[model samples]
Target: MISSPPKLREGLEVIRGMDDIPLIFDPVSGHYHRITRSAEALLGYLDGTRTRDDLVAYFSENARVDQARADAFSRQLDTFLAGLERSGLLEGSEQTEQGTGASPSAGGKRFRTSMLMPRVVLTRSLPTVLEPVARVLRALPARLIVVLATLGAVTGYAFGFHTLFTGTPGLRDLAGPAFLIATGVMLLIVLAHESAHALVAQYLKVPIRGLGVALLFYFMPVAYVDRTDAYRLRGRGGRVLLAMAGVLSDGWFCGVVGLVALNSSGLVQHTAAFLLGMQMFLLIVNLNPLMPSDGYTAVEAAAGLTNMRGRAFTLLRHTIRRQPLPEHLARFGTGARRWHVTYALASVAYGCFLAYAMFHTIPLSVDLALSVVGR
Candidate 1:
């Protein structure tokens, strides 16, 4: 073993919980770690005076790690140290003895949709900075808010379903300046969607870290609020509510717009109709449980796992490679595996659905393009 002391990066904030597992935040990377008790204790051994062997001996004894598990424990520790080095969280960067081959099902080789779409933060602590608004919203009755949101969502869906079933022969009407107005409204709805997430999280006393717009595949602008810190909620219910808030906001927005579409005339009616189309698209796509959007995050929160999607992908990877189930999968039990497998199936189905949607959805937007090209 390499004999060098590992020092944690300075100014790191660690939030210790009732479960003894602490959540460590690295401001530099904007990453949070929910580390086990042993892992939390291991950080203390990073003093410059301690050696690798000493650190291993200390954790191994405290962990009561048996002979069969000692090797695995050492490999994990070595890997964690390596990760810390990579993140610039360690003062000294030294290679460990073992390769620390992480389990694929345990987020070793997990993939992310964010890899396709990168984000840039415009503001941090946006909710805190807008504390006066949060305070006003907090005083409002939760039951009333939930009731209105639920009613709006139901009305939005009912109106939308009727439109879809009745056929949109009015697509030709959408090929006009009204489309431009609708596009602008749709953009505002995106911001409102993110705002809803922030408001709900703030009301729940879950700190909102930041809000920003990201380039989706370098073109489509996607707005997001950083309510990720809410994952540490002791109960999944709060996290689920937070996750669903954006979608709920879309429902209310579309419901209001749909009513205008029904009651208005001429240019106003056409613009409202155009927005209604976009809103339905948002509802269908965002509410999809398979996408990496709010619905998927809600599923993750409900399951109480931060790496739910990654773990699901890992299961698929192991199955394709014909490898034995990873050690972590063993804890899920048979019933859990059934749901995991179902999720895997849903994920695959979504991939196919997206392929079809893109094929059709692209041409649907061609009118907007032709308008630009003609000019």
Candidate 2:
């Protein structure tokens, strides 16, 4: 056995999560590890002063186990420490020495792109630059302003809906320039939507590392802001807010565009109306709970569950196969099991519905694209 005790790396922050779960955040790698209470206590003992034998003795005394059990525990402890070292949680791990892990900016801030989801970084210091705006948004006056804007947006939507469905312009009138202009404006709205998430993260003291644009799922072009530091937030409320901020911004923009369409005429009205429709469509898409959208993120945060979709699907698969629950899931309480099963059923049903909708909507979308380009 090694003579030296393992030392946890510096700059690691341990925070208590929901249900008093211990969450360790590594700032260098931007990774969070959820550990059990026993593991957390073990981490405290790894202060570099105590040797491996000392830790084994400590565990033996505290757990009140015999020599055989203590020996087994020492082997388990070695395995655990090895895993931690590989994860860069240890002071002298290969990852720490090589400066490698999930952190893309460890070398330098450059464009990190992938064919699956290509993205370009627009800024890396958004928190410092947007500090003034974040401050204003967190103030009481900003809340009042938001309230007023919401009211106006609702009024605009009401009138705009009536005008649009009744005796307003047709799609042909919105063809060519109007449609192109509205599409450009909608892209800007997407930027604003992502900015809202970053702003809220900054307000909650989460670091905003990078802000830019990306093709989500390699097809849907969208703005993206790096709010990965949100895992450090201890409160569910902050996490939910950070997730829903973009959706709220989308709704607000939809309302504003509706209001503009309601009061305008000719080309301007046509553009606004088209923009409103686009925003509303995207808002619905983002609110889909079956997908990894803002709505899904909010639900996961509120439930205090990580990777809910994956877990739910796994549980569903096991149930369908009539297999026993996996070891990890078998440890879940009755409430958690119920939640996983229920969410799995709902997600499957919603996914089927979406597939059906897409089958019918594809032709319509193609025609719409053709019409917009005046084909």
Candidate 3:
């Protein structure tokens, strides 16, 4: 969310007789100006259907500005609108036509305008097949996680887990193609996860809002489904499936890659190993249930929490109140209470790790591999 725009600098000339063009009047200091043509196009979008938050997002994506900049612009726009109202120039209807009375027409509805983007929540609603998937997830015996972990270990070993030492030559050779493939494959896996969520939501007759790259964390973009409307849904189980869909998709990918790793050879072996390792990383990291990742959403849904952050805070607040009171609360408290702390710390660590990987590890590793392969 962004604050309202600072009042425009004093004495800025108000462009009069530009009612056809979207214009703003700042009565606080008696200044007015025509909104840019692009801004006019944006104001034309005030259909009373799209939320201000959505408009802010449209600006952010279409304008290619960072969220903060977009938000600031939104606030500025709001100030402009407020100014128009103060000048007795606004008709309450966002649309301005020649000679339309500044007073709202009987049919005109006042718009609640502001430049605020709703927090992008990471929850999605489920479809008909979600129940089956949930059943699979619930019945995923401990043996499955162990088996998956062991498979991951095997693939990790194959993909140069031992390259921490005597440098696997083939592993080094796998870097470029591996980088390209791994990145592409990981993207595909994410797409599949999003598709599962969306298709299931569609199956259940939920309107899919839209899909786009979400900044899941700083420097990490993941596809997100806007399933907040699902909160208004009926059954708890369906909601749970929506939340768990992505992680289940990750597990499914891990299973498939694990099977391939057990059967392939040469470059296929390398590819399989890379994919298996990648899936394992996603499964483990994403399933941590700490941050706003897929697993966290699952945990939130399962715990009957309104939101992950809210759940964490409630648990923490209760824990603080119950100090020296009960064993159960303390024991279960970490899972709930410590969640926000864990998420914050983990995010910081993950960010640092990413920075290191990009600046130090990736360059050194890729350069060495390219050098070796070139040799």
Candidate 4:
């Protein structure tokens, strides 16, 4: 479970979206909120000291929203706080004077400490030869053509997928070399994916923070583009575009590899087929909606779900613990009700799926090695 900083007050600390939504913060007993822009401006006055009336007056003077409007917004804000409280995102009894003092526990910052430099390596401007490739992606139709050509090459290797003991070296005998060469091609395709993402970020005028490789497990190095700057885009569309760029590239690469392998003949063609198939498998697996992979981001972008997954998970656990409900029990809806339910269910399901895969998906050889041998 994701725990909030203990020092920070319970309730919505910040409401993030295009429209100004209320991000409530209930200290202890009293619930406070900032719905309208005027109310948000008054947050500066909360130096852990101001009274409610003082805060209200400050809002009226500095950011003038009529008293009635402000009052209405405040009430809605209170309602939101109450919901959060019931949902266990807020603490303390109602009617209690929430303190304006420092919290008892000033929790330290939570950081994922790593010896490795946390940088993604695709953001550096592409090499001259790669620039044309990026430009061509801007035209997706032509891009599809290139992908088909690659797939054709991959498919061309299939010599009828038969295993024969003839004088001629057959497809099965060549599987080893085929896998290695195919892996190399797939790696290039992976690079293409990273390049697309970086290029898109550059095109959008977003600065590439850095690029670096991540050690997947131990030996595998996954390329990454650090485009956190793209998150600052005002609209959901831009964010979605940046996120999808990689997946789009992967999909295109898969298509191209498949086409090439299926259309060719002989050992090289067979190798291409195997390699293309492997790439497609990787694409599908990586795009599994459960994990924080390309597919996960794509789903988040398409659904316009910003923190909806987090909130849903929070709510689902709360309901499970408090309601004593069975797995099949129907859940009640709240704000963004449908999306909340979907997001929560998906999050939980995906979480469980990932846990299962991590523990149980080891290779047979690894399991054999771990077993104690009794002679």
Give the distance in Å from residue 120's predicted Cα in candidate 1 to where it truly belongs.
3.6
RMSD of each: 6.3, 5.0, 18.8, 11.0
Judging by TM-score against the true structure, name the best candidate: 2
Q: Candidate 3: TM-score?
A: 0.47
TM-score winner between candidates 2 and 4: 2
lDDT of 1 by residue, 19-65 (tens): 33377665544556566676776787786677676777876798898
- TM-score to true structure, per model: 0.74, 0.76, 0.47, 0.53
Q: Taking the candidates one at a time, how many backbone clashes does each contain?
A: 0, 0, 1, 31
lDDT tens string, model 2, 159-185? 545555654577656655667788889
lDDT of 3 by residue, 93-191 (tens): 232321211211212223211111122433333343355654454555644644664465445444433332222234455545555566678788887
Count of clashing pairs, candidate 2 = 0
Q: Which candidate ranks first by lDDT, i.e. highest?
A: 2
Clashing pairs in 1: none
Worst 10 residues of 4 by lDDT: 99-108
Quote the lDDT for 326 in model 2.
56
Name the Cα RMSD for model 3.
18.8
Could you give candidate 4's per-residue lDDT for residues 259-362 as a string of tens digits? 55555666676566655555555666567665445666667766654443444555667665775532212344455556666767775576566556656746
> How many clashes does the backbone of model 4 have?
31
Candidate 3 clashing pairs, residues 3+ apart or interchain = 14-32
Write down the lDDT that model 3 would get: 0.51
